[model samples]
Target: LQKLRSGQDFNSSHQYPQLLPRRHCGKGLIDGEKSTPSATLYEFPWIAKLFNRALGYNCLGTLISHRYILTSENCINFYFIPDLIVLGEYDNFREPDCQLEDPTDCAPPLRLYEVEYVVRNHNDYRYRIDLIRTTENVAFEDHIQPVCLPLTSELKHFRPSQYTIAGWNKNSKNTTGIIQKETIYAASSAECQINEEHLPHNVLLYTTSHENVANRTYSGGPVGAIVPSSERRFVQFALVISPVERCVVALDIVPYIDWIRANMVE
Candidate 1:
């Protein structure tokens, strides 16, 4: 329920105080069970589904603040902006999705918000960043919260061994309505530039064990890693801005921390 204001000293550590620890980051309803192809009912609470009833287009987004949703440039390429963004959703077909172990333990219903406006970083050519402003500020709770952004320069450049990508695999024939998460291997920016000369230098390059792990449907989804600190909160490193053929390209969040903050407060 906190609002990010202008002229405040930016610090990633204190930005999102609602973020849970590493042990509860992606844990499902069950104490020890894990959500595989189907992410636990509330495993990734920041994930949002963008949709336009007129166009019938769907894309994944990350809830970055009480009123803003971060997505990719391609997600807003349509003629009209997405009219709706759904949060805290597990399965599209189920209402109050429950755990497999005990059906009685269920998650809260999905939160739907109407899109008020859209903002795109036109200057960012390498990996474009986009933000969707909701009509009202969100109420943060157990099943709804914002993901941490790389507010400091150190976090942006810090590369880990692996990154996590989560989205609704609606485009895949093998996958169902459940949210899916996969580990993508991080490739050095230098190596990525050498392999893909067309890509700009500001992006984070990644290679998946399977090419189909991240496709067009994952556009605007979050590419994050568990911050290696006492807090151990999940920090969104980038957005799935482009398509995945051989190398997956993303808009690195480190470079756009200032832009994101300005937009959030404005």
Candidate 2:
């Protein structure tokens, strides 16, 4: 908390060289996911890709700690198969993307970390909560970092507003390491029920625009509010449970802060 408030380094050094933005130009591996048209380096440093080792389904997740991953319980409830996570990857087709001549260029190495533990809150179909721990500490880099789990006081100020989210592209039939994102607005309970059929009180909506993304399988993607008065940092507010054409329903994270804090490793 002190490090976040002070803008100081927490678990790792908090500085990096300049990064250049690159546009994406590729189809996804399935019918739903598609690569982003334009992506910037270090833009979304905390998004993780969850891949089912046994089958071919993939979900998005958020790194809240060096070893803890927060995602939707529904993503893992159907099958108890193992999941591997890919972090800090941009182009799904390429690996070790060396944009600059210098090896010191700030791109992170491609990695696939295995899950070692799992916890799901299944009090109801509404919970939609899941917490996963990596087999080992994830290597931090410029393009890969953990997102902040805001203090309860900070989350309380989260007004219904614009937010950003990231997910894997499954539109194409080829497997890639790309992670795409979109801009959506937080909707009220009334608005949520309007777009989605039936959602519990613990869920909210993030609606899309006309030039919106083709909503595919983006479950477990991080839905975060850009700090209303803070710097270029974002604090996670929810986790996606379902993504549709014009709207995405996410489980609120604010209500589970204590549960998360107790399980996370420093």
On the 0 to 100 scale, the lDDT of residue 255 in model 2 is: 69
TM-score of each: 0.81, 0.74
In angstroms, how far off is 85's CA in candidate 1? 1.0
lDDT of 2 by residue, 202-238 (tens): 8877787724344354688778755544244567778
lDDT against the true structure, per candidate, is: 0.70, 0.63
Model 1: weakest 10-residue lDDT segment is 1-10
Error of 2 at 183 (Å): 1.2
Off by over 4 Å in 2: 1-37, 78-80, 98-106, 173-178, 188-197, 210-215, 228-230
Residue 236's C-alpha lDDT in candidate 2? 77
Over 4 Å off, model 1: 1-35, 124-126, 172-174, 188-195, 214-216
